[model samples]
Target: MLDYKVRTYEEAIEVIKEIGFLPLTQLVPNYPSLDSITSKEHWHTGSELDPWLWRAIFPGDGVAAYGKFVKKKSVLISSELLPLTRSTLGSPRSVNERYQDGLMSREAVELYTLISENEGIDTRVLRVQAGMKDKDMKKPFDNGLLELQGFMDIVVSGTKAKTNEAGEKNGWSSTSFETMDYWAEKNKIGKATIKVDKAKMKLKDHFTSFCSPETMKAIYKIFKF
Candidate 1:
């Protein structure tokens, strides 16, 4: 288990590297949430610490944060291990497959197409461009974003603070999303060396090594494997 007192981005990265992948909050048995493991007293009371970690690890030209795993939150999967995980999860579908599979909703296709066409985009701008600016579209828009992330078709590149009409910061940031292929290519990350079945077995063995049997059961339930 990681020392339950992470106080810095470096420490957080260390823990993530050790565990392979972890959630931002405590969920799976035996795995520690980023907040639960923080040593900073001020961070213990609420979710203030999460954004700091997000800002530090994402974007900036490296695959430091695997931003989609459980609960559509960040999952720290090291760049070295990304290929294996991607292989296990399966490849990103072509445009036709993505639309036809019934896995992606109409909003998801629109959002994904915008990101792909533009190379990358901030979430705030993406919503507007995708015609999801209406308040009623929030849930579907959010779900579409999560669905794309879950499928490994897209990933967060970084964050930009929301601003008011006066150009003042709103104290909240919107994440930037990009196609996984774009990010991987730009970063020079390679494709999976192993086949899907082999990747799955390897990933399972790796997970089993650190996660308890109960945790394993929970993982299986979540992934439905």
Candidate 2:
């Protein structure tokens, strides 16, 4: 088994590069779950590692974190492998087609449009601009955001600490997001050099080394390919 004990941001980047993709934490709820096998003690929350610090380093760090559907939160992906991962899901074209076909929900379209127009946005501000500030709209807004992220159309760019009514820092932060294409352009990330089918096979073979057959099936299901 590969060592998952990452104690520093640099170490975390190395791990993500080796694995190609990894959930930020060990508590992912779906198959190929990190919860059972990954040691919690090495997590950002549990250890000296902090996710915010990692995000701060991501601008040119060659690693990125975004929703991957294996968990409720984002997954860390190495820049070298991001294009291949995108290929597995048939991105860009697929996301655009879904939007054109009206397969995307109204909320998702609104969120996408706003992000597209603005380039990038903080979550709190985005919620207000997208008409999702109401408590009742929370679930739909969150789901819509996740939908875009899962489709590889959007990704978390960074974060800023939240402030209270008095404008004091609450020590909690809201994540900021940007379209994947925007991120790629800014980071100089390129498209996959390998064919999509080859990318899928490569990822599958890598996963099989560490995951069970059942988990492998789940990975395929999660990627929808």
Cα lDDT, all candidates: 0.71, 0.68
lDDT against true structure, model 1: 0.71
**Index of the highest-lDDT prediction:** 1
User: Which whole-number lDDT from 0 to 100 does residue 158 have in model 2?
Assistant: 75
How close to the true structure is residue 143 of candidate 1, measured as C-alpha lDDT?
91
Model 2 CA RMSD to the hidden true structure, in angstroms: 3.8
Tell me model 2's lDDT, rounded to 2 decimals. Answer: 0.68
Candidate 2: clashing pairs of residues: none
Write candidate 1's Cα lDDT for 1-225 as tens digits.
444676666666666677666676666777777766875454524354553544435444474545665567666566666787777664545655867977668888888889998765888888888888999999999998888887777877877778889999977776888888788878888876688777777778777887778888976764445
User: What is model 1's C-alpha RMSD?
Assistant: 3.1
Best by TM-score: 1
